[model samples]
Target: MATSGLLNTDILSDEIFDESQARAPAKRCDRHSHKPIDMYCQTHDKVGCSTCMADDHRSCQNTFYIPEFIRNNIYQSVSRKIQTELNKITKTLAEQASKFKQDKQRLLERKAELLADIRRFRQEINDQLDKLEKNSVNEIEDKVKCLESKIDDGLKQIEALEARVTTASNKIAFPNPYQPDVFVNMKMADDAANVANKYMKDTKIKSTVEELDFKHDRTILTQLEQIIALGSLTEDPTKMASSLFRIRGDKSYCVKVKSDTEDCYISSACCLEDGPIILADHNNKKLKQIRGYNYTVTDYYDLPERPWQVCSISKTDVALTLPLQNEVHFISGEEKMKRTNKIKTDFECYGLAYTNNNLYISDASTSVYVYTLSGTKLQHFSETQSGQKLFSNIHSIAVSKDGTRIYVADFYNGLIVLDNNGQVITTSNGKQFCGAKCCYITKAGSVLVSTYGSSVLQFTPDGELIGEVIKADSEGRSESLSVCCNQQMSRMFVCSIDDNIGVYGI
Candidate 1:
């Protein structure tokens, strides 16, 4: 048998693992039978005298005394054992390294696919915007050209009317040279005209023609007024060429962020636009967000090592309950200063809920506690007997929107429904339905709960278990949960202890 050594963690020897031949009895000389001898008369094998080395085993070059062989060969046994274990260790390490390389390759492929998708979607959007701008400008230019054509037609009509008016005025002001203008304008006539008139006067002595009076001409300017009032023509077309057409106003845009935190271990995270009031878990350290980005690190909240359950009531108000501390601390805003409410309890508080007028706490210590929003203890409800059975350890609590009912997640009792006055409305055993860590109701009235595994189980509000939100993994586990209702950019954020944040679109 081979013995293992420290170097076995690195590798194992092949000779130790595989044995080809069976063991045989040791061959020895008839005399001095107690002494051991090497099978092949090597350096570690025993030789009785010089005659044995020179005769029967003359081909063997080396020989040693029995005691000398044992001392030198002892170290070889240890060396063989170390090499055997080292071979096995190295084999296992190689397998693990191969698996790691495969995971890295898969991650790189996924990243490439996501980048390609983003680039493709971005290009599509840009192309659509370009097409829209081009079509809009083209439409605007076409409309302006049509209006200009109509204006040109109107101006042409006006010019024709002015020309007609000019012709009429000239006829009344100056008659044809050939036509006779008798009596008053005889001195103004030229010499050639007078000679021609004298010859014509003798031929036609009878004067029967009449001269018309030159009155101010008035014409209809209906088309001119229509063109000017319609504003189809600019006072100066050169100045009007640089103006832009007006359009309707644009709509508002927004961005949403969602986050989940666990003091012990952080696993996964998701982002939604404007779902919940998620502040940093600054009890461990300060939270810092990059400038110009949506996230930031604020202040610190002083607390014990473990505060398992936490809830955010508003943008400025947050409640954190601890197991060992047995107290609920209310923190507010970026300052992270403790408010007036520091409710102390003898039992451990697992979860916290806040209504418009009161706060509900699950102690898991025999009953639940109800308090005023300002830390005034109103009452504590202990589990009452039912058919000779008593229930205790109320695990979690959630209040209805209207504060009419309070829902409790019990350890063995499953889900216990209670009225506002602490009376049990119903009880259910959700052994196979719900899990241990956390659960919540979706806007669609479905339930989502975390289990011991890596995934979150989904269920109908009626307690029928549905499919899982995510599957269990060899690389990580999930112990926390969070949801987002309002997202900044049409996406919801989900956070968990899996060290990854998931983003989804509605």
Candidate 2:
């Protein structure tokens, strides 16, 4: 009977030893050096054999029975709880990763939308948007990396705790109940499993990511072209305006030239304060008008020479320039315009403009010639005080409402801006008007320029640039010949070298 009982104990011990070995290969005791571990020090989080227990762990607090821990917690509830927390963390991280992908995709698609014309102006804006997107994505990635680091550390701690608990649990769960070895080894694993349990309990895991979002400049989209050209786009956010133009046949219409004369070539266009449309067609040597409402052609008045440019002197009057004859013709009559008188200048007259009851003209000599309503040549600036020529090639001229500033579209030097004293302002040689053909001041206090770059540019009275194209379709068509505004300056007329003209709202 005694032999049978001993044999049964031996078999149980053998089975328990096999399971314990599978969980954790026998570890050396800390105090005993080469001996197998048989005791645990919960205070120090150490595992050891009998000698280690007496020599190192005798005074330790919170000791545990490994056998009880194995039966109660191991291969059961505690391990499952730790795994559930890890899975939750993984699921949360997956959602953060999805957000990162979605944000990157949106930024790339918007970048495509912002790059219409890749000129220096548009190119700069695209680069800014690109930089912003990259920085924004990097910010999100940094946050993700931070969260990932935290999660990895938590996972490692949890994994270490799980392994320690499992090893201790298996040692006690499989050991023989009647064996002295079981009783002796039980002391170490119990405390070790309890220590692991405490770590698992204290390990707090966060499963959510940090905040991520993008804040874009709303005005950047509206003035991206200007920003690209000028490196900045600024405007009064509260200023709102609209046009009161009525479409005649189509939104963009062509002026009637002559009787089936496919030879329509308009050099300049203007709208009088009273709403009559005047077109100066140099090719036909005629000044044309489209009456209001029905837009019916009034008549084509013949000139001494080709009328290269026309500007509204008043609601009932307009000034015309003849480049070949070095002459300016003043035409008056609201309904039917006729050449009232002709004034001769020494230089060939090209561009004609009227502001503050004064007529300003650009001549073939690249000189901005200003005159009174009586055709008296007022003060003209041929060169700056620095001896630099006022302009090398002048196309159009505009003066501020207060008559304190003058703006000239210089084909050779961009937009030449001058103060009341004829001193050069900042706009000269500005890239914004490098290809400018004609310019006019708006009632809303803005200067509008038509450029060979196939676009229109707007500038505040203070010279802040704004690029406002008539349409993307306007590019590469007939070159923009002239830009003019209505009585209120809310409506704009952009005339092409061809008969077709674009009406826009500022």
The most accurate candidate by lDDT is: 2
Estimate every model's Cα lDDT from 0 to 1. 0.49, 0.67
lDDT of 1 by residue, 203-254 (tens): 4533212331233222223222212121112223222222211212212111
lDDT of 2 by residue, 1-506 (tens): 12222112122221122235233327675556787764545455455576766776677664444443333223333345557778999999999999999999997986675554336656776798799889988987998898788888888877887787677777788888679978866887888777876776786444574344556766555333212133222235224112212323224666755462546667787777655678887777788886543445666787767778787777778888898998889898654677778788888888777778788777865578788878798978778787877787778777876778788887767777788778877664666567778877766566777787767776666565654545325544677888776634345677776666666654
Clash count for candidate 1 is 37
Which candidate has the top score in TM-score? 2
Look at candidate 2 and give me any clashing residue pairs.
39-188, 40-188, 65-190, 66-190, 121-228, 121-229
Per-candidate count of clashing residue pairs (backbone under 3 Å): 37, 6
**TM-score for each of the candidates:** 0.39, 0.50
Look at candidate 1 and tell me the lDDT of residue 284: 39
Instruction: Provide the clash count, candidate 2.
Output: 6
Model 1 gets an lDDT of: 0.49
